[model samples]
Target chain A: MHADYLWTAAPLIVSAPMAKVAMPKLAAAVSKAGGLGFIAAGYHSDHLEDLLQEAEDLLQEGTAETPIKVEEGTPKFLPVGVGFITWSASLEKALPSFSRYCPAAVWLFAPPQGFRDLIPWATRIREATACRTKIWVQVGSVSDAVEVVEAIDPDVIVVQGLDAGGHSLARGASIISLVPEIKDKLQELRPFPQKQIDVFAAGGISDSRGVAAAVALGAHGCVLGTRFLASPESLVAHGYQKALLDASDGGTSTVRTKIYDKVRDIHGWPEGYDGRGLINRTFIDHLNGLSEVKNREMYREELKRGDEGYGVNGRLTTYAGTGVGLIREVIPAGDIVKSLREGARALLYGPHNVSKL
Target chain B: MHADYLWTAAPLIVSAPMAKVAMPKLAAAVSKAGGLGFIAAGYHSDHLEDLLQEAEDLLQEGTAETPIKVEEGTPKFLPVGVGFITWSASLEKALPSFSRYCPAAVWLFAPPQGFRDLIPWATRIREATACRTKIWVQVGSVSDAVEVVEAIDPDVIVVQGLDAGGHSLARGASIISLVPEIKDKLQELRPFPQKQIDVFAAGGISDSRGVAAAVALGAHGCVLGTRFLASPESLVAHGYQKALLDASDGGTSTVRTKIYDKVRDIHGWPEGYDGRGLINRTFIDHLNGLSEVKNREMYREELKRGDEGYGVNGRLTTYAGTGVGLIREVIPAGDIVKSLREGARALLYGPHNVSKL
Candidate 1:
């Protein structure tokens, strides 16, 4: 089953399924460029069918220009994947979509009931797709990875770090430490001769350097979220895109907080999970003891400003990772994938590399 | 001056100058194993001579077994370096040590007055060593890196991230993002045809995978602190070593706080700086609203426990990075260096590697 989705690229690059931002175009573009991409199903399955259909249309159109090569004996499915916020997403509604258009994979994240909650979702997805769609579980801690692997035996484990954008574990190690430790624990729990479980690193990765670093850290590939926010294919507002570009020193310019969700009235994120975004008036005002009612009212007013609503003083949320500083310009999603692949390969194997002695 | 300290090792591994923990034996062992090492001068320059002399004796004794190869056209100096907390270190007291030992490098960190405070320190050290001792400044943010480069034009910049142990910025990005952004900014600020400034990554790096990842992230090498704690040569107590070994899920088990310093009666760490260590009763009590006076008294009591004072329930400060979970056992510092080097090289260029397709 894993062999069916084995990417031909030397270092697999994945574009994260950012809620509402990663749409059909971005997902198809990444897949066209030999990288796996995911369309976010978000917290609901209401629009999943439309999103999948749109992605299928784009991929079909691109097939004439640059088709993703499928290996022999591999079952037919959409090359792109879909992502779900497992806690709120309706498994019943999603199973029909899976049966209708089988995505290559389904990424599960932040289950309120823990890894066990994912077992039923995984079983249903596999049953719906006749085992065509692989299960990918996102874990921020070694314990979570161990439980996920034990409970559902996910085909791929995405090891996310504290430096990631959007939603993530409120407390987590950076990939520099987390990936190897998780790898070691998994090896101990499920020794060799078992089914292979590919590990993909996500968080704080923006360019080829990060991809190469993830590979060196024992990850089979990397999943980038903040980097794709700069892609024209991404379904982000101009204000949000501008905010991402204007941001620097992401470690200082951005912060992880539940305030954004609270202002937007987005609840049920599960304990120990929060979102990282560019610091703005909303957060500053919240920190300064602004009443919740007033802050929410101000946030709604800022939304009315549209493109002008996202900046240092803007109240609109601009979700990004610590790697936001590294993103300088907007590029095509396909181009981003291609450049990352080439750059990572060069750093890893090139003779005239600065990393070499 | 920079060329004088050019190491022959690929992906140069470095043992951090963890105050008290990184001693003469540990520094010399790492230097003997083809990696640069640094002895901590701590907040004061007192006892500098003893540490340097001990390191000199150890290196001299080990020269028969393995000598650090020096290339032609480079002036000779002690292969080991010295680190200082610039805010509290007395330059008047350190000059004589530099002149006498002629250490290869001086790592400057935590200057209260800002990057300018390091200029005089760098100038005097170069003059004392006749330009043999290169200056290495540690920066946690891109803005700090820019300021340091403009202020002193350091020979090397140690880019530290939030995941680092010991003292670091209260807020900072992970090396996954910070390193590449700093590299890009440095390139822009100091374009081609300028003296080269090597960048070494310090934070959350424990093994060869981390070393390789740092290299991939555009770093010349890595500085490991927590990984060295398990080394027998390290000046750590038995219980502290046991605590490090027992701790898993470092991202959750460890935290960055100034409470440790406060309890130890240590002060004058620059603003926006704090130390990371294993979480214990001291922190829990402090978080639970224990008065500072009472917390201090309890901390002193825990210290009397000696080798039994460093665990989840113990109050002794066990300074360690998020990589603490990755360190499993005590290995000789030299063996750690060799293993890290060999492992990184294999991962970077090996044919049958998991990172490569």
Candidate 2:
């Protein structure tokens, strides 16, 4: 089943699973647009199962009364997937019920808990469905990627560069440089047959040009998070969305930082993890020499100023990529997929078309 | 004259003017391989005229004695170019004698000295030869790129990403993401009669994969550095070359850092500039809790252990890219260019060829 899907069902665009941002509506919208869409299973430690169940039910809500027999190799949900912070303590408890949601595939990120532990999760998913549920592991460093291929054998290895949002590897390589390196390493591992691992690029990719670049850089596909952050279906509040749109004029507006994480009272990311986002009030204040403890105390009160307890309104964290400058509007998720597909097709052709470029 | 060169003389590969590393032989070899090649005019404050004279004479040395009356758009020195740390204290001294070199183009990096200041330098070149000697300004930020286009009106804009070796922008965006954003902004500036500025991607680009990716990301061309560090023509020391080869495996052997600058006794890098180099013994020692001053003291001694009192011995720096892991051998510069050009061609075509990928 996995072989069939990997061979035929690959899509040109895939929406990254964003915690709190990627919900059922966004995932379904993207999936419906012939792109893989995923719900990020993060932060909702105890209620993850319930959230997954809700998302799956919402995805299948419009199915025909007499379910048509699904074709082999073709996706039942088209492109619905689930992503996880694999290092989260909640993963062990959340693992057993994942098969119930019937995700087309699972994207596991930041497995600092070690690559071997991922074996049990992969085994469980494969065994539970009695069908091949694809396993994709994200590795920040090439060593970890090698370990994944040798130990667990993931269908896809995401080479996460230093320029990503939310939780990024503390010291990661640039995506374009890292992808080909990883591909070469994987080839050396399985010489004859050649390790058939698809490499997906993430970090600083926000537009059709980046997508096309990924394919050209020997990646099977690319995942976008910050670009989708401003899509209508994303849970980003109005204030954060405005900050994103305002930065579209071109400047050093966003940066990779650990400041927001400290102010948000979020704690305990495994060693070597940082976040990227629009440089907000808190970051500037901290850079200006405000103490971390004092900044945290001030942010606690400032958080109450906004409608929700999160945003760029006061000292809130606005997770985004450096490519946020390119995002100008909050359109539907499906429309983003369509525009990206069309734009990439237009730019990626030969000289006759690229001359205008 | 500028339009003719930009149109007819476009090449598939180009060697960047790397400080200290790029020499007469390396530049000439790259140009002979159908790629633009450049000599870096670095730290030659007193003998600026003499060095340019030597480089120019050397570049034209092997030319046909019956000089074929160079065509209008044809390069006088073929593909020979000269680069400068534009903000250097020596640029004023270097500027007056640049025409002597008869360069195809001048690559100016890190103009923190302000974009407007670059105009007189550009005007001087045009006046020197009564022809538009194309001016190229390196920018780390979009605003600087816009400034260069609108004010200085450089014929080419090199997007130097954060992953590049040697001196780079303080807080720059990734190359892939920045290229498209700058392109969009330039389009808005000259909407109808489109601004025909070409984008060149630099930083972390090693093999043909990076070149293909750059073109797909809207770059007219790409520049390579670390990959060429191992090229026999490169002037890098034996110790540095060996360290580069040993690190050609999957590991975090390189990083973007500033520690090297301090240890090397190099000073006065305008506020935000740093470097990307191999994580050598010095990096490991400092990480193990040595004080910054003590680390510097140790590096000073370790430096003297090598042939030229430099290298990866104990506390020396090996300036390179995050893709240093991809460089394995010390081949000829022409072979490196050939392989990169061929590899990029194969990967950049449509699905008919990429299916095996």
lDDT for each candidate structure: 0.87, 0.71
Q: Give TM-scores for every candidate, taking all chains together and pairing residue i with residue i.
A: 0.96, 0.90
- Cα lDDT tens digits, model 1, A1-357, are 326555437588899988889988999899888889999998888998899888878876645435464322323378899999989988888887887788999999999879999999999889887878889999999999989988999999999999999999988789999999999988888887368888899999999999889988989889999899899999999889999999999898999999999999899999999999999999999999998889999999888899999999899999999999989899999899999999988877777654446
User: After TM-score superposition, what is the CA distance of residue A225 in candidate 1 from its true location, in Å?
Assistant: 0.8
| Candidate 1 TM-score versus the reference | 0.96
Give model 2's docking category. Answer: medium
For residue B187, give model 1's deviation from the true position in Å. 0.7
> Which parts of model 2 are misplaced by more than 4 Å?
A1-11, A61-79, A193-195, A249-251, A307-313, A349-357, B1-11, B61-78, B192-195, B249-251, B288-293, B307-313, B350-352, B355-357
Q: Ten residues in a row with the worst lDDT in model 2 chain A?
A: A65-74
Assess each model's interface with DockQ, reporting 2 decimals per model.
0.70, 0.51
Worst 10-residue lDDT window, candidate 1 chain B: B67-76
